[model samples]
Target: MISEQFDLSNRLGRGDRTALGIWFWELDRVLLALILSLLAIGLLAVAAASPATARRLSSADVSLPELYFFYRQFAWAVIAFVTMLVISMFPKNMVRRMALIGFAAMVVAMLFTIILGSEINGAKRWINLGFMSFQASEFLKPFYAVAIAWVVSWKLKDKSLPVYPIIFAITGFLAMILMLQPDLGQTILLSGICFAVIMVSGVKFWKLAALFGMGIGGLVTAYFTYSVAATRIDAFLFGTDGITHDKLALSTLSAGGLFGVGPGLGERKYSLPEAHTDYIFSVIGEEFGLLACAAIIIIYFAIIIRVALRLFEEKDYFTILAVTGLVTQFCGQAMINIAVNLGMFPSKGMTLPFISYGGSSLWSISITSGLILALTRRNPFMHKQGQNRRYNR
Candidate 1:
């Protein structure tokens, strides 16, 4: 019946088609729609934002080739969609194993970047391969969630391996690479994901508290190892007087106001160095207005809350960790972008996920979201009926 409601193009939700149903609370339609919506918006945002990039690079006088960025983005969107659908259709066990393999591969790739990678904007974060370049951090997302979730779930099952040490090892290894890239923003985000997974998995509050303390200590040690990192952190918090990137982002956002200045009318975007990538949200706010920005935020929060709500009902430990970690990373990245936009935080060369432009960011985000989609799909009526049966007594 619910399948009928959503107009099932193919049989889903009963048995073989079970994974396709949107109404299933476990398969939460809203979340599915949200991910799809983001994918669609990524394409649209790329189309909208690319002309500005064209003008900036080629000057208004010269008729350059059709915007290069959007065409690449459109291609990536298709790949991302295929990736998401394929991941979603997978069985739970396969998803876990894929996570393991994927996570390990990304870790290696991330380290490899540090030693034999190209420098972009003063940081050696991307592993460039002549014709193409990819960021290991983006792929690190889903696989990291999968691997940690497995550890957490396994610990719940056997109660042997301690969570913190496992977390510390991963954290330290990746933190080193990120530091080499001089990406403190990513380092902080990774730490947050690990902390979130541990806490939500019911690790004792005392242990959680201790982990945070050690995390802070490790970061201090890191700062000493890398002066560039220490300076970025310091600059973010207490920079000398100047029209900083973060401040400029705020001005771009404020200039958009509640009703936006209309598309192609963003003057700030032309001057903003990372307009098409890192600070793309500012461009969205500038051209589409504050209301559009708020709408985007609301949609993101809704999907996150939807996933969290589902996790609360299922007793599976891995699912709990996987879902929570995914949401945390998703929201954490978005929050960082927002904070930087609002002047509450310093710039952190991060994209606004689906909304921001860039082949790497878009591809990585799309694939990661696919993992979340797989995690949340379920039979809705079955869950609802069970709830009714239990409460109606």
Candidate 2:
């Protein structure tokens, strides 16, 4: 089996018609290209933001390179791209199995994180793994979506199954733990994923209405309960705080106006906190211009639309739910990050999907892209009738 796999890979590399080659041809190349485009833009944005971040972080004891974050992000991007490519080659069954297993493992990891995680900025969200710190929630997001989709897809097998309740319970538990970590951003993202999945699963309109109501109520509760959320919300709504991160972000974002000041020429980014991670969108605005920011948003919309179009005729329940959930998670996060950067939403320490600097986030997003590619792969020559026959089974 190993030798056969190796031979197939060799044939794929040589552009010969083989199993691997078939996989490549069946892959959603347009979606892949869009993802890669974002990755490339992310690299440039990181490079532009790196100098300010490095300088701010530098001290008398240690001097860091100007492109410190950029170099590290570049390395992670290479690894992430390779990981995505390999995972995208997996068969559908393997993709589902991996998500199930990964979801289970990440749940355990999240528990460990709550118990023994390193505290950063008053949030215990990272587990130190010697070489690097691991954020369980980041890795858990994609897997959670796939797992939920897998569970909810069971309705087609038996309409009487309590799949919705099961999904809600799982999501609720996850949300509770996330709130314990005080990660309101991720909690909100996951809730959105669950809501999107349920909505696509044919739940009643009134039920979705109730769910949305609950979500809003939850936010209200968080405002009163979570100090971080309250502070940020107050800052956003009332402008109670002077020179907050959001204010700086908006100022930095518009500093370049339409065409930007050119890469690394913006001076405002130096004052913007989390410039390479959460506020990278603003950094891109400062250096790459508002036009680049608009283009990035368009690319995100294109990716979401591309996936929706691909799933138009999909008959498999799991495929529809899983794909919907993943894309919702992807674009939803991007929208929040962009909104926060524009001072339209409260500051959430959420990284801009593929355009932010973080090891775990980069890898998680790569996995998301890979799963999307894997689930959406189809033979171009297959007739609609043949495709339906295959999916209906």
lDDT of each: 0.78, 0.93
TM-score for candidate 2, residues paired by index = 0.94
Root-mean-square deviation (CA) per prediction? 3.8, 4.1
Number of backbone-clashing residue pairs for each candidate, in the order shown: 9, 0
Question: Which residue pairs collide in model 2, if any?
Answer: none
Pairs in clash, predicted candidate 1: 12-17, 13-17, 13-18, 24-380, 25-380, 26-378, 27-377, 27-378, 260-289
lDDT of 2 by residue, 17-116 (tens): 6777788778888999999999999999999999999999999998899999999999999999999999999988999999999999999999999999
Error at 352, model 2, angstroms: 0.7
- The digit string of per-residue lDDT tens for model 1 on 33-58 reads 88778767666666667877776778
